[model samples]
Target: MDSFPPALLAFNLLLYLFTYVAATDSLTAQDPYLKDGFSLVSSNGNFELGFFSPGLSRDRYLGIWFKNRRGPTSVWVANRNTPINDSSGVLVMNITTGNLTLYSHDSTAIVWSARLLRKIPNGVLQLLDTGNLVLRDRKDENPLNYSWQSFDYPTDTLLPGMKLGWDLRNNINRRLDAWKNPNDPSPGNLSWRMELHEYPESVMWKGSQEYFRHGPWNGVRVTSRPLGIAPILNFNFVSNEDEVYYQYSVPNKSHTVMVVMNQSNYLRIMYLWSATERQWRLYTSLPRDFCDNYALCGPYGYCDIRVTPSCKCLEGFKPRSPDSWTAGEFADGCERNKLINCGDEVGFAPLNQLKLPDTKRTWVNKSMDLEECKQKCLSNCSCMAYANTNISGSGSGCALWIGDLIDLKLIPDAGQDLYVKMLASELVKRGEVQKTDRLKPKMKISLAVIAPSLGLAILFIGLYIFKKRSTVKDDHEKIEAQDLELPLFDLSLINSATNNFSIDNKLGEGGFGPVYKLDIVFGKHRANGLGAEGQTNIFEALE
Candidate 1:
């Protein structure tokens, strides 16, 4: 090879150095990001913004992704829907329009552009440590007052500090749209957004239909289910005239967490980065089980995962179609066994540890107490159920459901209470049944003690009667044997002997009366006796 001149070699080296500087530096109105290895890296070196291809596809698109990760894990895509066929893509800030625009270098054709309402004269684009690609004025340091930010237009994943809700003042609704597939970054049919109603709720949608619902905020959390305190994480929700949004943050920056809406399985999953495992660990997921399905048990019926059938009618309610319910079809829901007369006495039966029902046709009073809520519900005949709006501290506020209660579930350790309205007769019957249920265990214990005592008493009485009869029989037998053993005397002989010797025989008075001596022999025995009047007495001394 021929050696280059000294000056030419030095010039070539300087040109290469300039290119390197352009590739790594932040973007400004004067510097355009070229697809030729040019990227804007966050100050902390945690994130990078540039043009890249996803999966096996050769198409190029501008996106922001984690820099330290093993592979390309894109967090946000700018031109996901539009792909550049070649490596001629350029991301440039238009100074005149105050917009960030992506264009094809060869044809100079615009692929995508950020639409801004007001023009910014001194705009600077920078990627932040929080994975946010922001466009702001050169003079402003406040991130909240940014001209344009990727956080406001989430693609799929919700990183810490990203708001997923509405900016009422700007009329912008921030939502998450899942990717079409792992390889394709285009928006998918599945999405998650906030449903604004009298009581706002976070809802996941499969196209236009509601797929899953996170029950309305009850002052503490977004859903009715309690999410215990996570020392590393903090969740926030704001609802006022200016905005209504929900966001989460990691207090410990060392720990990373993100929520992803998985399109393949139609699931909203939360993941925590594990430093020891070097992988994202699944923390939890939404639509947690079959019971989490929206309105799976229909109106007036609640789903319980702990039960076999899962679906059950609320108190004072019966299946609308018994046959259908038995066959596992619960869409028909349930009906009040005894219809309530609006003018008659009624009561509220409380169902504990439950996910509050839907609030489409509902009313709320932030300052009202639970008792006041009950009276308000009773005044409105259409009201089906009521619950506390806020359950923090001594629970405050009131929320009443006016129509049929829908999408109820039993979330055992982590849910609120819902009081359902019922007629006086039905309440009385329910109270009686509840009373019986409470007494069942006590009744069992009482029977266990009394039954054995009664049996022992009956057994002792029977033994006493048997012993008395046995003693009487034995005495009678003894007397009969003694009488048989005694010898018999001839009454006629005794009478003649006593009459012939009456006065003479009375020689001496005895204790028995006038006595006389008599002698008799029978067989081998001889007897001596004393006769008095018409009787004879025998003595052992004479014998």
Candidate 2:
């Protein structure tokens, strides 16, 4: 041995290490090394792990993925932050120390390792059907008594049994982060995490900017997500002195499911196995539109995708930055029409058919009823709104919004109701404003029926009410245009006004289509100033 060269000796030691790691075919303590030629397959054969490359990238990585899935479906990577340069990588575990380590081919470099906290010496490493790589005591045989597991450390994808939250005892924050891009499994800036503050809630962030939020769990569902279709499975959120985390389970064990943070964007996409298609089918997707953005409509503003301008100041509110709104930017949000009187002077304005606002600033009481929630909110000057946290069992529990309401969106026919605090004076203002808007079209149609003299009177009648308020003029015009869609004019009226488009009323044609002139009169005078010989130009509708 003394005669052997130092380089040759090192080479011989590396050969022994490689040969020792590759001794076993099954994934266990006896079998330390898993090479490219073989894989560590789950008990049910739903997943496999080995050296593999994603997309067309030349780099090989140690990762775990669905056995049947295709096209970059790896859920967890042992070497995510660090990539292996070649296929010369092997996964190994020390049976004595109970440390799962992956090394480079030559056995010279340690790539990644599972440094578990509690080391139970005699343990076996096995991949379970739930896609968890665990270290179990060879004698105990109970999974719960395992020393460690890979489920606690996740990458971009969340399998059915995996969690997305925190482990308080170990002070570890479990989160789901997206991949850098389609071809790379490296961690990206976008992440979906739980903010365990005053009220725990799920938030999606791109860098520091919030992209989407799942309002506090109400024991039934995410208040931010209205259940359009009944759920097929159950979602669980557990919080105690020991731990706080979110996880989901399927009703049937036969069905396979996964939730992935999509590579192209910051949306969470849910996929399920489709036997017919032989691939993962999109079960559902989140943050579907601008309304889904975290606090997208801003403070005191509401979003409705059905309307042209999605963002609008809630009733009894005005845009804080009119210029920002004019430019189609709404992050600055809206201001209250009247300052809060505080205490009992303020009244609760029930906002129905809308997604609840942010819950980080909310205060929750599990034992209170809706009425108790109302009384509690009404008594506190800081409380801006309140709602039943859980809508089950006569809606027990209270969730009070103590600050500005953010990320409110109308959910068409269904949604959670929010009773927002408002000045008693403005409580009737919203109803009055809505009533006025509804009557405007009727008023305009009725006013259009009258002669010229009364038309100004009707327009003045419509103008004075909103003009007195501090609401911006441009916003009012836009609102009118949006809410008032039809002019309610009949074809016969146009035909009558044009005098059946006589040759005398005919006008020159333009590049778009044809143009025509018309003369119209009302009962006593011209209709809105169509005088004795007044000419009205009717142009063809341009495409």
TM-score of each: 0.79, 0.72
Would you give me the overall lDDT of model 1? 0.82
Against the correct fold, how does model 1 do in TM-score?
0.79
The digit string of per-residue lDDT tens for model 1 on 39-64 reads 77787887888888888888888888
Off by over 4 Å in 1: 1-25, 30-36, 224-232, 442-543
Q: List model 2 lDDT by residue over 1-543, tens digit each.
A: 359889999999988865544342245565556776567776677777677888878888887888877655788888887788887887877778888888885888988888686786756777777888788777776756777777888888888877788888887788988988867888888888888865678888888888888777767777766666427667888766777778888988767788899758667888888877788888888887868877777899989988979999988889999999988999899998667764447787888877788777878888889999999988788998998877777788898888888888887766777898888778777778878989999988876777687877888977887676646777789998965764456788777766786666667678986555645554433442122424342221200
For each of the candidates, give the backbone clash count.
0, 1
User: In model 2, which runs have C-alpha deviations exceeding 4 angstroms?
Assistant: 1-26, 141-143, 430-543
lDDT of 1 at 20: 67
Worst 10 residues of 1 by lDDT: 533-542
RMSD of 1: 13.4
